[model samples]
Target: MTGEEGLRACDLTLAGLLHLLLRSSHHSSSKLTIFAAQQAPPAPGSRRQRHPRDAKLSTATPSYIYIPTTITKPSATLPSTDDTDTHYRELDLPSFFNQIPSITMDHRPQAWGRPRDDVYGAYNASYMNPNGPNQATQAPIVTGTSVIAIKFKEGVVIAADNLASYGSLARFTDVKRLRKFADSTVVGFGGDVSDMQFLDRHLQSLDIEESYDLSTDQAPRLNAANLHKYLSKLMYKRRSDFDPLWNHLLVAGLDDAGKPFLAAADLLGTTFTSPSLATGFGSALAQPIMRRYVPDDEAAANLTKEKAIEVIKECMKVLFYRDARSLDSYSIAVVTKDGVDLKENEKLEKQSWKFAERIRGYGTQVV
Candidate 1:
């Protein structure tokens, strides 16, 4: 045989060997079918000639032949609804994926912007919610009306009513809004009572820490000016984070120089210092009354402590009558060099609607 015929015979033998190997290892689950090219049979009575390459092809298997096989997974058996005739059902992927979470349909104000419970499961009882930004208070409930404060010759005096109104309803009447920090400072809160309580707790913890750190008598305590600065920074930080404390505060006491210090801070961290300061409705009603006596530092320096207390009490009485949210029962504090003297249960004396009896259209009177 010629050398070309021997080469053709070697190629044909390799193709036949590959085809045989594939057929032997074929899987029943596979859909692939491979066919080897058919070559013409050798001439009648002609002997086939072998090539040296055919020796290698005979003993060695081709490394390139690969047949992909399919894996058959067993079908899951679903529970028979007809056999049980029950409404209960197991959690399934289809239902979990398709059904709307209940949090999405909640119409309550507090549930606003909550994530889909189906995707993240129920929200953990924590300050943070997963997959969403932390929520801050948008509206205040259970709120105090106003806080009034005045700096006098000796020190400062601050006052707030005991009423915590729920919407228009007067809900809690005995909530004291005055907090005495250390001995020289008094803090008065106005606005949301809950936020006020939170701040109160925070201040208490801070006071404990300060006391523990300043064990020596020579170490000066945190004065009203420093405390006011700290609180202002805290409020501003919370405001920057879009989670402000929903309360207006009045910090009253002696400053580092032992002079009376009076300042105010609101939810936005806006602050101002005045001889007489008032928040909420007091800014409109009682402010005018207090400013008449202690309008500036000169007036405050001239005003006596006894006269300052009387003026604050009169303003509270006026607030109780003019401000609907104000209460006849209130708390008052006087901070002097001596210390803070706080009265939490002061009541308006002889305050009533009897004066309206003199008006022609008052009560059942004619117009």
Candidate 2:
């Protein structure tokens, strides 16, 4: 062979061997180089410091990303709900800290000193940027759709597809955002993932004590009416500050007045008390049916919790049957003064047979 031709053949042989080595090592060749944009390391000596202050710092694990960290224990200091509005106004969370003097403790991971925000920004993900990670174009992580819920005789029920798509990708199979607060309230979230997480963290900071009024012997609860108003107000406040919780929400629970409550809140902070409400596709497809039950000022008052829940479930079933982006499995929550009940991992009916029995234009029907 000519000298040039011999060298080219050797180079190809080496490249083939390297490709085989990369495959066996379980590391794709493309992943070998770290992107230059995300190369920050933690500040030196920051890891050895102890905490004299009690600001909470939580770590974000991929699976259980948002675990609660209660700053103040509610064992002895908690108040019962019987106290008048004046009492709640007097119970300042910051004041509780002043009474405790100081809690010179750091509950961070042994290797982590400051908030793990910086630590997670590295190593955990390969191509993340401060602006966002490499997957910025990958669509939202926890997108919310409008959920319409109505109450039933025994309890309330709400449903969302067991789908958390990465944009239109249908990437995550099990992301149930509906949470039951103290077994009494079912909070259905609709919107961007980061905002949802922010709200979750904010709620966790409420000390778990403020959720209920104690004299009532109620579990920490937020009826639809209360939750709706709180979210609307918060969303409005955040928007005013130029940071919005890109979410629409439906809070279903019994209000402080001991009556069923359902309300809608949006990123703009606009809120409306409704017998039924929906966020995304539900607004277009399910809203009409929900409105049938809760249409106008007169019908909503007559609607019962049992009926509302049934209606919501029917809407979910329809969405599953109709909405191409939805799935059969979903989560459901019921809220009342007694507490919240959340159910995840719901399944839709089987449709696998339809594809197998297709009459025409079928897969691999090479005739």
Top model number, lDDT: 1
CA deviation > 4 Å runs, candidate 2:
1-142, 152-156, 211-224, 296-307, 349-367
How close is every model to the real structure, measured as TM-score?
A: 0.64, 0.53
Overall local distance difference test of candidate 1: 0.74
Q: Can you write out model 1's per-residue Cα lDDT over 181-262, one digit (the tens) per residue?
A: 9887999998888789899999999999988989898987899999999999999999999889999999999888999999
Q: Report how far residue 57 has shifted in candidate 1, in Å.
A: 55
Best by TM-score: 1
In candidate 2, position 78 carries an lDDT of: 38
Local distance difference test, per candidate?
Answer: 0.74, 0.57
